[model samples]
Target: MKRAEVLVALGLLVVALVVLSQAIHLGPGWGEDGPRAGFFPFWLAVVLGVSSLWVLVQALRAPGGAGARPFFPVGGRRLVLTVFLPMAGAIALLEVVGFYIASLIYLVIYIRLTGRQGWPLTLAVGVLFPLITFFIFERWFLILLPKGLFGERLLPF
Candidate 1:
């Protein structure tokens, strides 16, 4: 268990370091009156990297800490698959369906998968939530979300 925790912590730290480096390379560009686009992300990456390093140090130094448990256990295929499947699908959907549709689909899948809600309620909330957001952002606030395959069809209306 301690070994597993150490491994996970180190892995997370390495990933964070890589991300932090990338974020730093992508300079924050100054916006109208606020910080640059990459400013927040860059700082967030720095924080994540530092935190992960701290966790790695703790896990390594106290292999058998009294209150510690294994970060990952052996033969945890179900756990890996459970998280990876949805994330992969979301990445694919994000490209093909655009953010709005992808987000709606992701939310519906998540609510149903996690909450086990009824179909009718899930459908209602899923559809309405995105619609309302679209109305408020696109129509009222003049904020545009990505339009994927349905972009051209929406132009007339």
Candidate 2:
């Protein structure tokens, strides 16, 4: 577990450094219009780098460093896979069915199977969630979300 934590922290630190470098190239300062393109990314990367560094230091400095503790206890891997597989499927479905439809399908399956909820509540959430998201993002915000191949034809507005 300690080894895993250290490795993950190091990996994240590297990713943060890479993003920070790119952000610097893009200009992290504010311009006449407003904040530059890299402002948010730069700040976020700095935060991530600092947090990861702290984690790495803690993991290294802990007593009995590199302890023999298992990364996951019994049944933990199964629980993780149950959630992870569905999310991965949803991400895979994004380009094909678009965000709203994919999220609806993902939520319905996840809520029904993993959560073991009643059909009424599951169905209600499955249908209404997407509709609400559509209204919020598309109608109110005027932000165009990917409609996918069939979504463009299926959606009336």
Measured over all alpha carbons after superposition, the RMSD of each candidate to the real structure, in angstroms, is 8.1, 6.0
TM-score of candidate 2 on Cα atoms, chains taken together:
0.60
Once fitted onto the true fold, the runs of candidate 1 whose alpha carbons sit more than 4 angstroms away are 1-58, 65-68, 72-88, 149-157
lDDT, residue 107, candidate 2: 92
What is the number of backbone collisions in each predicted candidate, taken in the order shown?
A: 1, 0
Candidate 1: residue 20 Cα off by (Å): 13
lDDT of 1 by residue, 1-157 (tens): 6777667777877777776677666766566897766777777777877887787787678748656654556657667877788878876886676666777798789779966899888888888887898889989999987766764354433
Best-fitting candidate, measured by TM-score? 2
Taking the tens digit of each residue's C-alpha lDDT, what string does model 2 give over 1-157?
Answer: 8888899999999999999999999999998899999999999999999999999999998665445677888789999999889989998887788888888999999999999999999999999999998899899999888877777766667
List the candidates' TM-scores in order.
0.51, 0.60
For candidate 2, give the lDDT of residue 101: 87
Which whole-number lDDT from 0 to 100 does residue 14 have in model 2? 100
